[model samples]
Target: MSNEQPPSEQPPPDTASDRLLADMLGLFNRYERETAAARASQGDTNPYDLAPYEDVHGVTNEYEAARDSDDPRALDQFLDNLADGFHLEDVRALRMATAAVQAAMGRIALAARERGMSPDRIAAETGYTASRITQFIREEKQRRAAGDQ
Candidate 1:
C-alpha cells in the first residue's frame, strides 16, 4: 500500500485570504488586550473626559426650555434633536446631566409631597413609578433626619 495520506485526511493549504484574516484577528486581539490593560491601570477612574461645558450647558438649557413648554410634541422634538447631536464622547456628560435632572425632579417631588401630594398622584403626574416616588420620599426623609442629628 502507498504511504501517501488520503485527500480527506490532508490539511488544506493556507491561501492569501486566510493569512490576511489571521493577521486582522491578531491585530484585533492585540488592540483588545491593550485597551484592557489601560483600563486596569486607571484604578477605578474614568478614562474618558467629560464633554465641553458649553455643549452640556446648551443641551441642558434646551431640555429645560422644552420641559417648561409642557407640550409632549416639543419634548419629543427636543429629544430627537439631542439624539441627532449626540456623539460617542458625550456619554459621560450626558450621564452627568441626567443625574442632575433626576436630582432636581426628586427635590420637586419631595416638595410636592410636603404640599400634601400623595406618591400615587406624583407618580401619575410625573410618569414615574409610585415605588420610585416612595423611594425618593424615603431618601428625602433620611436626609432630613441626618441633618437634624
Candidate 2:
C-alpha cells in the first residue's frame, strides 16, 4: 500500500511560526533603521566607525537569510564567512554591542516586572524562561545598587 497522504489530508500551514518569523524580521529591520537614524544624527560618518556597523548588519542579514533556508550548512556558511570577512577587533566591538543590548534588555525586563507583569508573561513575550526573567530583574536591582554606591 502507498504511504503518501492525499492532497485533502495535507497538514495545515504553520501560521503561528510564520507570524513569529515575520515579527522577528520586522524587529531586525526596525532596529537597523533606528540605529542608522541615530548614527546619522550623531554625524558618525567616519569609515572606521562605519565598518563595524556594516559588519554587524551583514552578520544579522546573513543570519536572517540562513534562518529562512532549509540547508543544514547555513550555520557553517555563516561561520566561514564571518571568519573570512571579520577581524578580532570587529568581534570585540560586536561583544561590546551585545553587552549593551543585554544591559538594556535587563533594564526593560526589570521595569516590566516592577510594573506588575508576571514573569511568565514577560518570558512569553521575550522567548526567555520565567526564571531567567526573574534573574534579570534581580541582576538589574543589584546593578542599580552598585551604581548608587
Candidate 1 local Cα displacement, residue 129, angstroms:
1.1
Model 1 Cα lDDT, one tens digit per residue, 79-147? 886667577667677678778979877677899999999999999987799999999888888887889
- Predicted structure 1: lDDT: 0.76
Candidate 1, residue 59: CA error in Å? 11
Candidate 1, superposed: residue stretches over 4 Å from native: 1-82, 87-92
Best by TM-score: 2
Which run of 10 residues does model 2 get worst, by summed lDDT? 44-53
Clashes of 1: 0
Q: Per-residue error at 67 for model 2, in Å? A: 5.4
**In model 2, which residue pairs have backbone atoms overlapping below 3 Å?**
none
lDDT of candidates 1 onward, in order: 0.76, 0.78
